[model samples]
Target: MSEKPINDLSPVVIALALLIIGAEAVFQLANAGLVGGPRGVGWRMEGIGMFGYSPAVLERVLVQHDFSPDILWRFVTYPFINVEIVQAAFCAALTLALGKFTSEYFGGLKVLAIYFMTAIVGAVIYGLLVEGNAPLLGGFTPVYGLIGAYTYVLWLRLGQAGENQLRAFQLIGFLLALQLLFGLIFGGGQSWIAELSGFAAGLALAIPLAPGGWALLLHRLRERS
Candidate 1:
């Protein structure tokens, strides 16, 4: 594969990703210290104290600290909540993969905007649909955003000739199947719901961004010709 642009690995996005991961690590360390340790962290997960990443708590803190609620709702702080190493790793990897492709086609800023925006959408949908007080933790939201980005890419690629079209359709089918299988095995909840939302967002964003997407306008012009 050809090399992606520098902005795909842009310092701003990379630094932002690292800073979020670092903040989560620090928060976990502090939580462990005040509580006990890893075992204490487990207890915290079990609801021993002001433990776990709570959107409610985060929202409250943002307001108290004078941050705009709109900013908070935009998932600016959501990335900071994934303290687990595996979760953070998954998020970073997915971000790089999806960001590279998205930045390649749509530009870095647009990719970033889509990722964050869809992440917030996923989390908000989860918060509204799931039962009361079920904390929406983990980087799955943004990770799903990356999945969304890939889906959008596939959709656009489908509009191309030959193998690209076949590959695009194949990928979409695979993604849908994966979602269904996972939902069947684990039962529908936040992860599944978020994944669906991410897919939807990706498709929606891709519609306007794809080259062939505007072909309809050209087609109308040709008709008038």
Candidate 2:
């Protein structure tokens, strides 16, 4: 029997799953009075938030409420706890698109591994650079990583001996311009830092993971056989 092909669930999907489920569980425990908030919000609460980039607040929460590192992990994880409906919806749409494409192009396991690795890099970068007391949350970091991978695939597809090369370069130019526009409008912050990390990670991973567009090369080889 032929081996079952990998599913198109991206690394972001897995991270989001963990974030959503963890949030639900925490909220449920809070509702049942089994667990209290890190900031002593008590049960029956709705505006609970995780410490995003505020390591100091996180440390205080852990010390004051006796919370563990697991709680910290939940707050920092992707698909961050955002009460804003619009923000959540926007992230969800981009997550689905980037995650699906990346997973389909690169194997699911590889995508997951790369995503986590990049997340670590992103978090570290943000922590070192960003100085603030507010919470940070969002999956834009990993989403940026997916964009990096997509760009690599595009470059490989276009950087060839055909019309595709011209098309790919055009697409790349457009994407770069878009990134610049968003950066200008949004201004520099933790989000931008995460995006930068994602881009760096994507480019790093692409060097080995993609390398002249293995996907296309494989297809050609199969056709020959």
Candidate 3:
């Protein structure tokens, strides 16, 4: 029997999962005084301050044309910082699941690129669209990108199998519904802008990032003409 696709995790996926989970682990341990020094209690907050994405910084650089490495790095670095362990755990689990299946088709480097590229797009859209004081942090935005890729893959598979391609969107649909419920209950913030944008960007990226994606795009274009 064939093994489940989730078992086919790639190096990039494993690395990404480890980075998110490991960072949270360190933060949790520090809070419990099991690791780091006496100052470890503040490690989580410090990490957020240092690594989290600040829209204020992005706006300042964009308006003033002063793009510094420190400010720019937040686009990618923010995904590594999570405010809580539960959030980190969910993000990491999604990364592993989606990354593994997507990697089976897109390869490890492409999978890595999807994560970074979607993250940047998400942050850019978030910065441009939302007006808030809180700096954005966490991997959900990029993991949502992976969800886009996973959905695209499922779409293609369903299409080839003569099944309902719309079914591919069920995962994202459920997730969005869950997010909506949480937002209604907990009063969520503008982070949804980043995540939703990431998913859209990821869906678009599937065209170029997938193997022979550009060629296929050109072929379709030629057919339409």
Q: Which candidate leads the pack in lDDT?
A: 3
- Choose 2 or 3, whichever is better by lDDT: 3
- Point out the higher-scoring one by TM-score: 1 or 2: 1
Candidate 1 — which pairs collide? Answer: none
Error in Å for residue 60 of model 3: 2.6
Give the top-scoring candidate (TM-score): 3
lDDT of each: 0.60, 0.59, 0.88
Instruction: Estimate, for each residue in 13-119, the C-alpha lDDT of model 3 and write its tens digit.
Output: 99999999999999999999999889999999989887788678678779988778877888898998998988999999989988888899899999899999999
Candidate 3 stretches with Cα past 4 Å from truth are 1-6, 217-225
How well is each residue in 18-111 modelled by candidate 2, as lDDT tens digits? 5644555565566566777553334213333333444454455546774677454643464455434455566666666666777776767666
**Model 2 ranges with Cα > 4 A deviation:** 1-51, 55-68, 71-78, 161-188, 211-225
Deviation in angstroms for 143 in model 1? 2.3
Candidate 3, residue 171: CA error in Å? 1.1
TM-score of each: 0.66, 0.60, 0.91
Score candidate 3 by TM-score against the native.
0.91
Put down candidate 1 lDDT per residue, 90-182, tens digits, no spaces.
776666766777667777776777776777777666655665555665556665666666665664455533234346556556767886887
